[model samples]
Target: MKRSELLTRIVITIFSLGVVALPLALWAQTPLIHARIAEGGGWNPDVIQAKVGEPLYLKFTSDDVMHGFAVGQMDMQPVDIEPGKVSETTLTFNKPGIYTFFCTRWCGLNHWRMRGTLEVTGSETNPPEPASPPLYVTLDLNLDAPHLAEVVPTEKASARRGAELLRQLNNLPTYQSPDYYRLRSSVQVFQDLSGSGLTDSQRWDVVAGIWQSNTTPEGFAEGKELYAQNCAACHGEFGGGDGVFADDLAAAGTASMQTMNGDMAMSMQTPANFSDPQRMLGASPALLQGKILRGGMGTGMPMWGSIFTHEQIWNLIAYMYSFQFDYPR
Candidate 1:
């Protein structure tokens, strides 16, 4: 062939190779992440590198049973990952930070352990403002301390009665405020009401009113749904500590009596009984919020700081108080 013909053939061959190679390069950029139970190694490629304000494509598949894919602190619906099938989602982050991703479904006893992280890097045009400390932290509470109510109401407190009573009282304690309710327990509120001339039972009713006023019926329903999905396995449906894992937890505690600090290990202890008036009533909404957000230290309670929003955490706290008081339907 002539030199010109040979040059034309070389150019055509190079163009064909580039067309095939471009697609392969793009495919290589997106990785397939695998999901399995914690025992089976949890999420494969658990650490993902991403860029801020750029679309990140994640492909997922379950190695065993069905699993869910969700990023913490994100406002996206979870995608299901069925065994032998692939599920994918594309996300773009506005800020740069380390974000956690985890399974949304209750896969097993160790479901909470299935968590991973995404590291996003980029420049921010408008940096986020600093957040204030949580109320429990600001109050400097010892979350592990046993807080028992000094006075237990003879009858269940009624929110409907309290609302009527609230309208009649001219002077009221600051207990009605969200900040007050969050920081002070129902028992504390009852103590504060001693000067109000209301009977002990009436004081309890007023406390119930305060709780009811802070939350809505819709919020309670949402909280109940969240508890059933996330907490019922370890804390019974009725807020009793007789869940299916209670016995196993007790056994675990018996097996490991002491921890590294020579203190009794809370991990082996059964979950807290929300129905216990003394314990539940003594815990303020802020205290409960702290516990739910931070999780129990070495108590087998997983930290949900990343999983739930601040409003959702508050709603859960309000529902917890429902086990102690009777709110109007």
Candidate 2:
């Protein structure tokens, strides 16, 4: 052959070789499709569709027990899966069709059914777009009518005061989990105040009747002492709303002095004005008792009916009535 023709022939051969290697280069550059073997015996998805020539990458996990992940009839190692653990693999599917995978290990009776399929199509490319936001909703069955009721005392006496204390606790805010966690300190304080030996019911009785009338001045003094011992931290000694726990209670959105500002409009909620003569003066003993038993609705007032005995509630009422005598504006 001529020298020029030989050179031209070599150039043509080089160009042809480049054309032949181009497809292989493109194939090596294909993106991989990654998937997981999630716990619960089921793949996160039982079916996956991929375009031919795309690389397949598999990720799997077993949240409960050990299981095997085999794809397209290919034998895989008996990977010991554990709870909260995961495994993965990569395989390229050159052909288009339905490919199935199953667990090879004896993962229990349902191991046979612990299988899934992947569909491969050549024409389509790109995954489908997500249609909507993954919105989560919950039905709160516990948030219906308040779990409290009001009761009226038949007479105006110290027991009504006891009933009011019950109302205070009953109307306590619906504590969040965090709030309850924070209450640990308050619980300790309360336990120290009433002593731990008392049952929940007894402690409530002490708190309710600690402030009421007494057959003697000494009895009344004893009641006041008890109030200081068991109730002063939250209700204040004079019931003027200053309490050791008031700030913490308010921070946790519990009712407190700051919440019971004089102007009902500035108050966190409409607080019961104990000094209001029209509201308090005309109230019959029965009405006052009822108010103590059943706290005002939608406020932090709670039902004290179950917390104090009827007699205890009456004594507390008399003590509260004494507030009128001492602090009548």
- Best by the TM-score measure: 1
Instruction: State model 1's lDDT.
Output: 0.86
Question: Which portions of model 2 show Cα errors greater than 4 Å?
Answer: 1-226, 229-231, 247-279, 296-298, 326-329
lDDT of 1 by residue, 102-206 (tens): 998778777889999999999877988897888879999888899998888987899988988887894565667787788888898889888988988898899
Using alpha carbons, what is the TM-score of model 1? 0.88
Number of clashes found in candidate 2: 33
lDDT of model number 2: 0.46
After TM-score superposition, the amount by which residue 121's alpha carbon in candidate 2 deviates from its true location, in angstroms, is 70
**What's the TM-score of each model vs. the native?**
0.88, 0.26
